[model samples]
Target chain A: MNAPLLKIDQLSASAGGAPVLHGVSLEVNAGEVHAIMGPNGSGKSTLAHVLAGRPGYVITGGTVRFDGADLLALPAEERARAGLFLGFQYPVEIPGVSNAYLLKAALNACRRQRGEQDIDAFDFLNLVRDKMRTMHIDEALLTRGVNEGFSGGEKKRNEILQMLVMEPRLALLDETDSGLDIDALKIVGRGINSLRAAERAVVVITHYQRLLDYVVPDQVHVLARGRIVRSGDRALALELERRGYDWLLEAAPAMA
Target chain B: MKALERILADFGSPADAGPARLAAAEALSTHALPTRRDENWRYANLRALEAVRTFLPGPAPSISPALPPALPGYSRLVFIDGRLQPQHSLPDTALLGSLRRSAAGSADAGPVPFAFSGDGRFGLIARMFAPEPIALRVAGSLALELISITTAQACGSYLELDLELAAHAQLELVERHLGGAGPTGLSCVQVDLQLAEQAQSTHTRLLQGAPDALHYDTVAVTVGAGAQYLLRQVSAGAQTARSTIQVRLSGREARTQIRALATAHEAQVCDALFTVLHEAPGTRSDQLFRGIASDRAHVACSADVQVSAGAPGARVVQSLRGLIDGAGAEVDLRPRLTINTDEVQAAHGATTGRLDEDLLFYLLARGLSPVEARSLLKWAFLAEALNAIDAPALRRAAGQGAAARLADTPATELLQ
Candidate 1:
């Protein structure tokens, strides 16, 4: 009714001259969580990256509308300033930039874009500390380099911490739970769930439904070969877990 | 050859010439200035040397130039145009008592040992014409700050610093080179360090010459048994700057660590060469170099480590990285290791390229402007070396200096 928060229509994209997503369409409304379940090479990450305006992807034919504006027209940074966040599957390790510095800089950048003043240093520290507690991240890690030498679970937790702090309008998480253990996954889920509001949307891209156990999605979509072939509720996720992706792969072509 | 001849002619021996000074002048007269053909001098900007019309020492400025704020917990020594300004120095009498000055023909005028094998012409020139050399022998813990300021006179300046640490002594030295407004001419500096058994020394050098200045520095160090020498150097100024460092572990269990960063912008050229030799058994050495070049600038670093057959159980590690940010800029890093013994552990890596694209994208994806992202990455690259500075005050000063050179914005903003 209020024009879905994000509208992707017939989106076809290619990476390195090879087509990855072929005429896929999806819509995500505010206040709803969507789970995009797909097997390896299903172009789940590509779809998320394309929407977030990552370079090196050529949109063959498509359009992405965020909040009724042409999302595909903005650069990656502008897209970020526009309240779009993409949680990288494998977070990068920036050895010389401390975690606190990055978090503060990023938060300030976003605030400046929104015509707001920079967050006070004292307030920022308190906010970060509270979020770190929720994410189960050690306070010492804030002084260390950004994810530098962090274990797999720690990196995932850091991504979640960043997401909770940024509070984007739409969050596209690409396999953030891949390397996370059960405890860490619960923390990450809590971190993500804390950001849900009547005006925010989240798209969780994963192969398994374990993350959904903590942050349940209102809608589930099975993407195979770059196209969403099935749409259902939470039962769809359990069904996929019960029956591997082969059945979907078998039905994907016909559905297309 | 003409440049060498001109320098020799301009720098006639002082009237009180000692044997060491005379020997240095004689050495220069016999050998031509090093050219590109010399392997060690291949990357040097020799043209800067040839451009000099005269190599005469600069006269003291009529007005004292402004100096950077002094570091806490250190006594300061100020030098203007190669001449010590005693009035501006803050001397700690107990430790300053060991400080000695030797002019030509003075009793302390013995030939200073230099481990550098490259063209020793620069050191020779400094020896022949520099003002009274400052020599310090330390027997107790001390912190000293030496500031050398070159005024806006188109004349050469030279300084030689010799340091000797007694057994089990500890010393921290912060040396800074600042240039006055406009062209500061050529400045040559030679430093020799000798560490006794179990002695430790931490030396940090900052070179911030004027935009049109030419700088050449040579540092030679010998570590004795169980002694440790650490050198943290940052070069962010001068149109053509070159520093050659050589460290020799002569006694068993000696150790040395060198962390150097060179930031070159505009059309400037910055070059550094580090050679470490493990001549005794159980010696260890670690070297890290980071260079950044932008806006048609050139930066080069060459690290060479050698383990002799007699130096069994020696360990060596070298990491050299360079970043080029401009289309016309160039960065070169070379890490070389030569081991003659089977019981040596050596690891070396060298890389020169633009900033990591993924790292850049990660920053951009977080809403940082491109300029902010680039500056942050560049700061991070240099911080790897700057962070190794043990003193927090010195580290912040160095970081601010480096950040200033890499960006047009305030260093505090960029560093943050």
Candidate 2:
């Protein structure tokens, strides 16, 4: 589909000298939603952090492309500027820096890299006000330091708020459902659903099928021992939830 | 000669000697000022202070400097070389009254002649062996009261402000050490403030001292029962400015908070020592000090907390965080606690680190140049404690002093 928005060819990432994702190849066409699911140690979070360019995660051998650009060669921030976003498994707390300020800076950064002049603060705040309303994110939260002292639910919502503001082309949700209640799950899922667009792609990383119930992905892949050993439609997630990954391991080879 | 020794010798006689003459004494103390060579004082430069040994101490005739007075509003304590220059001070109409008059005028005023000793600027500042001390008593029960102290001269000086805060009093003491290089000299000054019963005294000290001078000052606060005393100090990477603070909860139900901050650049060294003694029942004390060091500068200090068994229902938490950068830059933080009681809550933590790379990436990705990102993070380290100040002017001024220090960094882009 028009030069896959993101293509990961045989991607392998490691942490602490131990490999997590091993030779995993994936491709996401623009406007596609790809969900990666597996049992524990499935490297879901690793892929998210590695994709985000967090330090300590080494990409051993692979090529990541975004909009046909060499994503692997770019810094995490540059990748972000190129329309990539990662909703962290654990949103970091940066005390003293207001969330609104950070989001505005991030949005302007992307715009500047895309050859647009910076928007004035007055206009920028007005734009953010609309996005905050759709996500149901508290304007008060935006005024506080970035995620500092926020509850588990608030942090997840804050991440979605950033996604709403940044409007990245490729968004990676890393276990965004953990620590969220049913009500919060619906709110977060609705937030993600609203972002679905013909020009945007999303990667949902989850361990529970409950999250999939709301933010249904078009495709789901099971990762075991680092490699994705199974792939299918949304039903695969439900199947894995019914019978854990151990059953699949009996039928599959040690792909990792 | 070592800067501290020269400082001690200079103050040894400055009725007006102003720490300027000790520049000639042989630095016999084999103890080198902390350096990259020394482990504790590793982040700070000991030599920059050594070179400052010769500048004569004098008052700045000029209007301002790279680092000017941040807190412009307040009754200033103007000192030059250990002597108070009343001429440079605010108008004589600014003098409220004598300590006794202050206590007598306010219905909430308490006792007088409060004193305590803790190893720090106060330990040194307390050396006013003279029987008569400078006393300025304040009207009790006044809200939003502030006293500003200005170190106008470039030499070592001693200042003792005997303040009497009547019961249920809220007092804000803003002390700004303003003045730049004069003969490239150094100075050490002592500041003492006394608070009365049920009084809430919030003290914020902004360091705009001579870049190359040695600033060693002390704050002795003896809080009364049901009284609240909060002390906040920000240093602008002094050549060697060490302000020691001693807080003693001598009365039951006393609360004391000590938040001291230092941001050092180049080879300057700023150290703070705090001695908090929980000697009374139901007393509480908290200490948080963070230092951001860049360019081989050094900031080191120790927080000593002593909670005797006699003081039950007391809680003490002390935390020290340091961000050290550049090859030789270092921060040495030591938090010592002696708790003889089994019923009190006591926690001590010390963190020394460089700028957070992840946070740095997050900021730089947001379009902030690398320098601006680092500056924001450094300022963030201070906002928690400084923001707690109620006075907008003093808070803004404190923030300015912090920003000016960071602005001197070679890679700083935020200042631009």
Candidate 3:
């Protein structure tokens, strides 16, 4: 009876004058995690970026609605304040902004947007420390520049750390498990799973099914050639991991 | 012609000026003020100097300068306008004394090192009328602070500083220049430094001038064998300011490192020129400069590093970054390296760009507004240079001052 938390209808987008997503549609409800898996160059990351309002992507047609609001109309930062978060695949390395300072500024930004007072510096530090423990992040890294000179696994953990601090209503995690090791993947998965609640939703875009094993998805969709060619459940990801996408491509030769 | 007459009248007579001043004046008379054709003056136009030409020179301000927080076991010298304020300066010890009093019988009685340059009209002008310098010699590890103040009066002022460190000596020097509100003033400063064999020196300079004052500074240093010279500078708050720093590694294994940060706002212009020469084998130099401009401001940094023909194993590296935040904000960065030697390592990088879009989006996704995100990035761009400062207190103060200048730039909002 209630509208889905996110609904993408006939969304078509182009990057650098080349169309990447063509007539792709999907719906995600709260309290559920959806995984979109495909082979390389399947527009998985593009969908995440478009949803997060990244520039350089031209939307030719279709619409995206979040909580029944026209999500496409909001700016990137405004969308963030309205409870949308994106976990970058390759986290940006900012050489001068300390991790702790960034987290505090971001948390305060969200608080101000909700008409709430900012957290005190001491309290903010405690909050970050607790999250850092769960994320297996070093406290020393918090004093250094954001992701500057951080290892691949450390950068991924930082992305999740930020996600935990923001507690956004709708989160898009783009290949968060790509560069992470096995242990890091588990920690990141546990961190994401902890945020699962009745009022929040997540969309995980991954190429490998190993991530889906930790963060079990309620639904799995196969995207290829700018379109979603198949949709299934947990079993679907297992099948793709076993048989690869050749079977699906053979079935939809024209679109592939 | 009228300006020269006014200068001579204010200066009294060339007879009183020691040989250094006489020679400097003769050179100034022979070589005219630099024109646009001169490479050094190409980016800096001094038409405004003519406006303040008639402003007569006045006596040094007698007011006490505001002393900075003292470092433990350190020495200090305070100067107002160009004259040394002995009562306000630090207590004289065995290591520090007035140049006139100490140099009377020492081997240093001759002309000060690096005090004369043919291309410096302002340097020559400063030499003609400036009082004796406040000098300090470091025989052991020492920390010194030099404070120069310009009051509301004394519209045109000249000051000079001279330092000679003994062999194997170690010194850390901090220079602070404060200018109060004044009639269109011109403040000229010359620093002559020499580092004996195996000596080490770290120098930090902060220049905060009046909104409409003109500041001209020239510094020359020669490093001996196996010596090291490290200098960091931060300048702001002047309508027109120019600094020329020259260093020559005159002996084998000598090295120099220079890190400079400059900012300008509200129609101000700041220029920095650096020249480092490697004349001895195995000498090295590293130079980095960063500049930020907003609110119709202009900032420029130019550096040249030369490795002489026979100076093998010489190395030079340079990096420059500039950020332009508002309309009409101009930033120019030129890093030039000339290596005449076949076996030398020299490299340079210079870039002027706006905030990165991807970086902005990352910040935005974390819930920061467009303006907040932009402000953070802009501040970070300048903080990169500030962090290189070794003194924590100075670094903190410098970072805060840079932020105040950047507060006027409005946060950039998303186009959508």
Best-fitting candidate, scored by TM-score:
1
Decide which is better by DockQ, 2 or 3. 3
Residue-by-residue lDDT tens digits, candidate 2, B15-59: 422221222112212222334554333333335556543333334
Listed for each candidate, the true contacts retained, as a fraction, are: 0.74, 0.28, 0.77
Give the interface RMSD of candidate 1. Answer: 0.7
Where in model 3 is the C-alpha error above 4 Å? A246-256, B1-12, B62-73, B92-119, B152-154, B407-416
lDDT per residue as tens, model 2, A1-256 = 2888888889998999988889888888888888998878878788877877777888888888889988878776787888888887777788977787688778878888889987787988898888778767788887799888999999998888888878889899989999999988998998898899999989999988898888888889887777778889999998988888898777656644
Compose the digit string of candidate 1's lDDT tens values, residues A12-119.
999998888988899999999999999999999999999988889999998889999999999999999889999999899998888998999888888988899999
Worst 10 residues of 3 chain A by lDDT: A247-256
The sequence of per-residue lDDT tens digits that candidate 3 reaches over residues B40-84 is 776664765765654344565656556667655667777777766
DockQ for candidate 1: 0.82
Model 1 over residues B1-416: C-alpha lDDT tens digits?
57888888886756777777777777777766788788878888988888886788877666666877778889999888788887888878875677788765365755655622445567777777787688888998988999988773667888888888999999898989888776678998888889999999999999888888999988888899999999999998888999988898999999999999988888999998898989999999999999988889999988989899989999999999999888899988878899999888888888899888889889898998888788888888887799888777778777766765674332274443
Candidates' chain A TM-scores: 0.98, 0.95, 0.97
- Would candidate 1 be rated incorrect, acceptable, medium or high by CAPRI criteria? high
Off by over 4 Å in 1: A254-256, B105-107, B407-416
TM-score for candidate 3, please give it. 0.91
Q: Candidate 2 has what TM-score? A: 0.83
DockQ of each: 0.82, 0.39, 0.74
Per model, how many backbone clashes are there? 0, 19, 0
Candidate 1 chain B has its poorest 10 consecutive residues by lDDT at: B407-416
